[model samples]
Target: MSAHVLIPTTSNLPAPRPAPDRSGTPTPGRPNRERGSSPHEGERLRPLSRGQVEDRRQELGDLYAEVSGGGPWAWNEARADFLRHLASDARRPGFSLLIAETTVLTGCAYGFPLIGAGPWRADFGGHVREGLLRRVAPGRLFVVSAIVVPPRVRRENQDRAWNLARRLQRRLLADDGAALGVTLVEARNDGIAETLRSWGWRSAGDGTLTAVPPGSCRVLVLTAGT
Candidate 1:
């Protein structure tokens, strides 16, 4: 069976209060650096053990709510669904999570290694090249189930959000020593699809896949070096 996945949705919520500057003690009369001027300032990506994920469930839920505003889905319902999927994903083999934070959780991403032939070829509706499938050995294909950075972050500084997501994905793939990373974004989520493409994630075939439904989702791929 294919793993449960949460396709990210756009949120219009206002940006949360800026995370406190933890780089150093603030000096009186010194001007604070502009927020997001340096995307990497005070930010670090840390892998979360399964136990740590459980411990931070509440925080994760809140972040989901904050980023997945109540638009097409109610905030409560969306958050509940996110928690459920997260629980199931955590059980998958090779599941991994990384959170980007300064003083608070800024963003997060997580995924697991695909098993056997995986669900891509079967669900891809014959769009994936057979040779490509064969080349990616079993357990070498990582599926990035979700990358949740607040929409506000993207709006405030697109580069910052992009960098965070890119770092999260790269770390996960490197940690697993996977040959390739893949993600399925709804075709309608142009914002995400474009962002992923800009970050060097290429479309699998014809830029769309049938995993969710024919032409409903797009399969994006990122090779180890790329």
Candidate 2:
């Protein structure tokens, strides 16, 4: 495991909070909400090194369970699957993890650069033109594997949650200097698919490209500066 690295918070976002207390609790402070300030002003966003991610696996799993919203068995299964993916993804070249928090972990997003032509490309089923792929440079394409934000946050202030999600995605892409970002959303998950579309992601293809059951998911893409 490499030493953890913390990316400096962007100037447009809120400044970092005072150091946490010995108990690891964030100090109480008012959010800076000047005009043009980020809606996520009260939260801090930081990138986690692979080492840091391994250290926080349990905490991340719990957060995933909470966000997934299921009974005990389902939660357990979801957490396990999340852990498995995290382990595999962490080893990929240029893997990056960004987490948001205030008093506790509120959300997380992670991904790795898409390097070379892999089996996953076949999943696109030719929807992603070869010429387009060459133009973007596969190495410059980042795949956002997951974005997990608790439901309560969305329930209380959906706009804030939306901004947070966007911040996480953009930061990840910026960190890698990626030209394009890609993610897949289940076709049945209309809420998330709609959210991604509203955020300027265009659908490139459907699950027929990748799913055992056609139409199970949709592929969405966001080019840099879009």
Candidate 3:
């Protein structure tokens, strides 16, 4: 993990929180070329809206559970609540959820803009910059709440999971003009943080956490603009 953790210190500065705590990663069959399949082979993509989130809420929850390593109850609760809010126009109007399904539910990338102060501030541990608060207000920042890929996908083709993730991020960049992107990753888990680094996510080196099983989370940032 990075040295600049998000925990509040004497400096009274808080770095980014663990990505909603807990975790995820992905694999699959193939979506077909007409679907403009993945760079590898048969893998198509589908972009969803808040409305779909409302409709597939249960399925979404199940997917997260199937892939994520268990965490503290509080961390789990916060994660659930965050997804609930994103399903509404809660963060409006820049949230995103993309699912990649082939023979099965391969993976997903989901998020919402971190704008305008609200109860959400408490989720990140109240020590962020006024500038960040201002920048995230509505359009300046986007927070990735979840990223998941089923074990089947991971077992069959590891690269495919990342391919789906990259596609999802690309779509987000195409749709949201936000300057920055943020997401949480397990700091000491099995190489998840390292994989993200290869994908261009920069760690803050701070041990900020949003989930329990204490000291296992850290946030990563990506300047998503082309």
Candidate 4:
């Protein structure tokens, strides 16, 4: 087991909050992509519209069915509950969720591309080390969690996960102007530490976590100044 320790601290500032319109729809025009271009391209990260989220969720359902044959992924029930909570969070101020999809692959059923202005409740206190402070400031875009589902779990699938995580990190970090801290959470061990490293994510020196009862569950946190 690894010991938990607090990251360093730099400064304290008021956190920024997201805005909203009561209609439960994104204001007026289409949702903004940070780059002013299509999503697959290097577009800016913006809050996904309600319709877009539903569509992405449906796609995830399809992917789950195809891959698991209707069985659940490691902890499918809990993951499903998390997705519902994300939808509710989107309705509140200072919270936004974005979903990025591609025909080539699918991500976690509950996991979207990233969350914006996410309430990053750091259990380990901090000035984050690992050379990220210079990249992002406080109250930009904070990614509370992220999930990546490989094409398959075999040895060959390692490359797929690595490529997917790298693309996600790039897209999320492209618009640092409206971003803060990006924290990516994934199943630990299982040959993923190297994949995250390949994507330029350091350990953050925040230690690691394990699921209760010693199941095939572990969690690692990675941060990048966004």
TM-score of each: 0.72, 0.70, 0.55, 0.45
Give each model's whole-structure lDDT: 0.68, 0.64, 0.51, 0.37
> Which candidate leads the pack in lDDT?
1
Estimate candidate 1's alpha-carbon lDDT, on a 0 to 1 scale: 0.68
| Candidate achieving the largest TM-score | 1
Question: What ranking emerges by lDDT with the best candidate at the front?
Answer: 1, 2, 3, 4
Q: Answer with 1 or 4, whichever has the higher TM-score.
A: 1
Q: lDDT tens string, model 2, 5-93? A: 11111211123223323221234684434224445467788999888999999999888766665467766876787787788778878
Clash count list over all predictions: 0, 0, 20, 11
Ordered from best to worst TM-score, the candidate numbers read 1, 2, 3, 4
lDDT of 1 by residue, 142-225 (tens): 888877775544443334434566677788899989999887676556666666675568787555433445446666788875
**Model 1 TM:** 0.72
Residue 60's lDDT in candidate 4? 45
Kindly list the per-residue Cα lDDT of model 3 for residues 1-226, writing each as its tens digit: 1112111111222222234311222215533332233333445668777777678777766555445434456346534744554455334446677877767665677666765556654554343434544554456567665556543332223334245455566556556666777765544542555444544566543433334255555667666742
